[model samples]
Target: MPLPLYLLALAVFAMGTSEFMLAGLLPDIASDFGVTVGTAGVLTSAFAIGMIVGAPLVAALARDWPMRPTLLAFVVVFAVAHAAGALTTSFPILFATRVVAALANAGFLAVALTAAAGLVSPGNKGRALAVLLSGTTVATIAGVPGGAVLGTALGWRATFWAVAVLCLPAALGILKGIPAGRGGDEATGKPALRAELAQLARPRLILVMLLGALVNAATFGSLTFLAPVVTDTAGLDELWISVVLVLFGAGSFVGVTAAGRLSDRSSGPVIAVGGPLLLIGWPALAVLAHEPVALFILVFVQGALSFALGSTLITRVLYQAAGAPTMAGSYATAALNVGAAAGPVVGAATLGTEAGVLGPLWASGLLVAVALLIALPLHAVITASRNTEVQR
Candidate 1:
């Protein structure tokens, strides 16, 4: 990978931290604003909603813009939004800031993926994406936990202030590392909205998007309620919660690294193996949740498989939407956010049932099964299409 790619990764790390750190800080935020925890939880949904709406819109508007400047602009705005969020006392203002920050974060990631892919050869596209995505994995491991610690020590506002400060290096890295005129073919003219939409409307592309969504839904559905399950079912102490989360994050890092390398050769085998692994892992997790040792092992395994599936799904989308790579990345972001947003709803609904704490794991398994069914046929269709093209 190039130096510039790592710069993009740094930006991704900062953005991802901002996106996820709120989960740990919600209680503090709610209390500060004189609201319930449930109301504060809406902040997470607001961020996802912003990503869903902003990604495609920003990608379309900036389709012809040079990648470096566009990325820089987004990071700067993201930093500013964090600062505003940190300073705001009113709940409504903080909510608005979250949405604005998410929009910037979405744009930054969409352009950064395109920029990273452009810096590498076609054969290394998967690896490039993996390296970029590792930032998010790292954020999960270090940034989220660190933010929680900071929020605990100095209040939630301090965490946001720290995030705003962290963005400086990422913005500086973007300005210095990314070269001018990289990404997109402005000389060829900006793609018409209809052309971009046509590319997105392909059957194979839609399937790929669905695959992305399902993978996220399955992973997050169970993960969203993991703490309760671990405590209620596994009989683990509250102190072990952070340890379990760390284990999951570590597994995600390893998974992304392996998936990146393997996906460079072909994504099909990775997905073929990973999908079934997820299918098995989730159900096993449900049954094993009461066993502390087994629960720990299963959580790690599930996290690894989920992230591995995500990497391949992105690679598959990039391959399927070759004509509109930037838009493809944006759409992929939107699809994943859609899943992230939906997963909690599904998990919460399942939790309300008699199935109790283990319901989320079982629900996640069913979602994975549906995804695998869709994936098997979609892979066959994509393979057949490629074979036909090769024969010509």
Candidate 2:
């Protein structure tokens, strides 16, 4: 892989840390801002909303700009937003900072993925994406827990400051390492917005986007309520919660690594196999949630399957939208965030009923099943079409 790709990963690590660390700081933010925990939690929603809205908007607007400059500008804005967040005590101001930071984050990721895809040959796109996504998995394992510890010891403001400082190295790396105007579709002229929009409007691309959304909804819906599930269903102590989460993160790392290699051979097989694994794993989790040993094993497997599927699904989208790689990358980001935002709502609603912890697992499994049903036929159609073309 290119050095710039790793630099892009570093930038992604910073954004991922900022995206997830808020969960650990929510309590502190509530206390400091004199608001309810639920009110402080709105900051997360604000961030996701920004991602869903900002990704395509920014990608569309900046499609013709040089990749390095666009990425650097977004990172600088992200750092500034974090710095502002660190200084703000007012709830509203802090909330606005989260939204702005998320917009920058979304824009950066869209460009980074597009650039990463362009850095390598067609056969290596999946692996390149895997390298880029490893940053997020690593963040879940280290950065999020570290931020929680930092918040507990130094306070939430200190954590924000730490994230702000973290962006400097990434910004500098992007500025110095990434080649200018290399990955963009348009080098000397503006991107054809009508053509990009037309590509995005394809039914196959829409199906892939739906697949992305459903898969994320399946994984995140249960994951959003993992703490409650671990405690309520498995009868585990609170301390064990961290252990389970760490195992999940480890699984994600392993899965994405495997996906990088396997998806290079073909995204179709990976998606076909991994999607069913998720469908199987979720229901097994639901059934095994009461059995501590079984539940722990299942959670790790589920995490791996979820992330592996993510890489493959994105590869599939790239394949379908070969003409609009950057816009397609933005669409994938937005779809995942949409699912991320919705999953929690579904989980929360389910928690209120008789089903309790198991509801999310079941809901997630059903969504995955729907996705698999859609994906298998779509893959078949694409394969058949390709075969027909080859024979001609």
- List of clashing residue pairs for candidate 1: none
Model 2, 189-268: lDDT tens digits are 43477776787667776777788888877766776567667777888775566566666777788888888887656667
Model 1 global lDDT (CA atoms, 0 to 1)? 0.79
Candidate 2 error regions (>4 Å): 22-42, 87-92, 152-157, 181-191, 231-239, 290-292, 382-392
Error of 1 at 75 (Å): 1.3
How accurate locally is residue 303 in candidate 1, as Cα lDDT from 0 to 100? Answer: 77
Off by over 4 Å in 1: 26-39, 182-193, 230-239, 355-358, 382-392
Best by lDDT: 1
RMSD of each: 2.8, 3.2
Query: What TM-score would you give candidate 1 relative to the actual structure?
Result: 0.89
